[model samples]
Target: MRSSYLQTDLLSEFDRLQQQVASLFGGFPSSIRSDRYGSFPKLNVGTTDDAIEIVAFVPGVKSDQIDVSIDKGLLTISGERQALFANEESDDARRYAQERYAGSFRRTIELPANANPEQVTARCSNGCLMVTVAKHEASKPRAITVQ
Candidate 1:
């Protein structure tokens, strides 16, 4: 009997911990949490001697809706994802069981020191935004022949 009670208590504790973690990440603003699973948009910023590359994951959004810009070393991305069911125009509020997220979101990233603002090119392909900032001629790596 004691072992059964201990097992039940452990299960309850586990449930509470799980709920806490979910709530913590669930409240993350839509700007960062683009994924339906409460995961934030994943971004990778890398540098290769001549350029800097940035990739952001943004799903369920159209290419036309997204706007990307770079200013003063700041890369900003903004967009609005219209609600999926807004067209139905139903006023029923009792049918909701699970709602992940919806609406506008914006994210800003700081560019690297050698990033050339004017040479940045961005493209959105299959829900991922890829931005490449080519370095200026002066910043590109040059081979120094060791005599």
Candidate 2:
């Protein structure tokens, strides 16, 4: 009877430990399902009739500073952000200055199997980086007439 009580206590302790761990990691995000606060350059993905559209909100990043590439059905976007020092006094020092972000950032996105790498297009404008991946010819929807 004593050994059985010890086993029950051990089981209860393990259950409590598991609950504590779960509560600690419950708020942690899994992949892109995040709320975008912890993610840099939040992404918007959508599918059109002809292509898969992706937009990365990259404010204060220049077109030249951005790099986009695709290989093995994985699209990668990487770049470095230069630090900005704004507002200065007579001697060249700021009294109150805040820097939101700086340095290198890299993000990878998995493309669909039907996405044609050759038809990929990327453009940066108005603080947004837009990427379009065209679908394969055979994967596109088409109308068929019944015989």
Candidate 3:
């Protein structure tokens, strides 16, 4: 009975450690069902002297299917990815694994305080969404000449 109790405790501890590791790696896990958003696209954020840049990786999504919007200092990207095996030819195939993300997904990113929502621009090219938000004039750095 004591050995069984020790085994149960070890399993619980292992599960806790696994969850912590998953959270550290941007919520990615070994199990398919662990994703809270159902395998949405990943993004990269950066900033230039004048603008903030965001690139979202959406391989199967089209330009027209995506919706980009900014409201109250939040940038939202939403779209739907149709299933690849929708056609009749795939109906008879036995599916062993499906790791791709299908269906609708929405991701919201918070804009910086200096970001100018009015000067935002977004374009989709080569399965990536590039969004640029210009910084406010008052927020940009200015040089003062020494007299």
Total backbone clashes of candidate 1, pairs 3 or more residues apart or in separate chains: 0
In candidate 2, stretches whose alpha carbon ends up further than 4 angstroms from where it belongs are 1-38, 86-99
lDDT at residue 137 of model 2 (Cα atoms) = 91
Candidate 1's TM-score: 0.63
lDDT of 2 at 61: 96
TM-scores for every candidate against the unseen true structure: 0.63, 0.68, 0.73
- Quality of model 3 by C-alpha lDDT: 0.87
Residue 39, model 2: Cα distance from true site in angstroms: 2.3
Backbone clashes, candidate 2: 0
lDDT of 3 at 22: 77
> Where does the lowest 10-residue lDDT sum fall in candidate 2?
86-95
Question: What range of 10 consecutive residues in model 1 has the weakest lDDT sum?
Answer: 32-41
Tens digit per residue, CA lDDT, model 2, 18-51: 8888688764443544442335677898998899
lDDT of 2 at 2: 100
